[model samples]
Target: MPFTVQYAVPMTCEDCTKSIKKALDNVEGVENVDFDLEKKLVTIRGESAPSQIVSAMRGIGRDAIVRGSGRPNSAAVCILENAQGKTRGLVRFIEDEEHQIIIDCTVAPTTPQAQQVSIHASGDMSQGAMSTGEKLYTLGMTSKFGDVFSLITRQSLPLMNTIGRSVVVGPPSGPTTESLAGVIARSAGLWENDKVVCSCTGMTLWEERKVATTV
Candidate 1:
């Protein structure tokens, strides 16, 4: 099923928009692309993975941050972290109208050997990934490029049931003592998050983005 995703891309001129549009045009699964130059936003209606869309924009020397995706109550996110509390990467789940879930994930500092990713029954983190309960679903294996590992796939998992569960990434054989894990949480849907500044932190979106990138 086709869904909508919004991205904040800085644009300084009409040429920038043209370049972005042209680049996205070549991206498979993209159905439509709309731009808001004044707000520096691009709303894409398609089935393309968000990572792929961002890569396309980067191909043209532009950077894009996902603002929102999917419909209300159809999106979720997880921030993967090691037991030491350092963020390793992020995973996003967007469910389409037909209930198919799109799993988009990126992690780093992984070995060349493929890693197995799965969802656990527990969200407990007192002992890190070890505390999570039995694995409920194996999402898939991730391919490593350099030190980073990325995976984009679709699954039939029910998004609502997965919230508060834990996602673990470990050796292909299964999760080990060194596996990374994170609790799944709800995320903003398309046009659902439009705040320029976070009221809790008083930081602008770009400022928050900078901090996120560094971590």
Candidate 2:
């Protein structure tokens, strides 16, 4: 259901309203924001937790209260790992119209090179991504300095298939040879050594869409 959550925020002028609006704008799943200066009420309509909205308000040096009902949506999460299966980051996955998926993660830099993130076959990070063969699909590249990765794909496949799968972020493939090891090596530039995933949204963000709708 489309839900509305109101907050008692501190606002004294247009600038405050603007600041509040800007802060609220970054929150995911937010649909609409309205305010009543007289009551100091900030009404938000969306699907995300009210706590997120409240936290956004606090981010701008304002305090807020959840003046109404708020609930969380369905989500999947994973811990990103390196080729040796060491923890590297966290990944959160959400849906894009049920046919697509958005992977959002705060990753620690695992390599000196730019990293490519992709959905793979195996969920086990121990085998690293070697077990998770095939690109399945590539989300995109993350910078070398541990940046936020927002990879989106309009998947014709099912989300359930991704459940036991893996999201690997690693350096682009290196040189390839005709050797058997090389055959298993890059998998045609789709595989790399520094691949990592953490313990895990895009296209148009869920925050940018109608909150009531879900995949």
Best by lDDT: 1
Query: For model 2, what is the C-alpha lDDT against the true structure?
Result: 0.48
Which window of 10 residues has the lowest lDDT sum in candidate 2?
179-188
lDDT of 2 at 56: 72
Task: Give the TM-score of each candidate.
Answer: 0.80, 0.47
lDDT of 1 at 1: 65
Tens-digit lDDT track for model 2 on 65-154? Answer: 333223223235566555444455655444323333334444554444556666666554445556566666565666432133223222
Predicted structure with the largest TM-score when compared to the true one: 1
How far out, in Å, is residue 215 in model 2? 35
Q: Candidate 1: which pairs clash?
A: none
| Model 2: per-residue Cα lDDT at residue 141 | 68
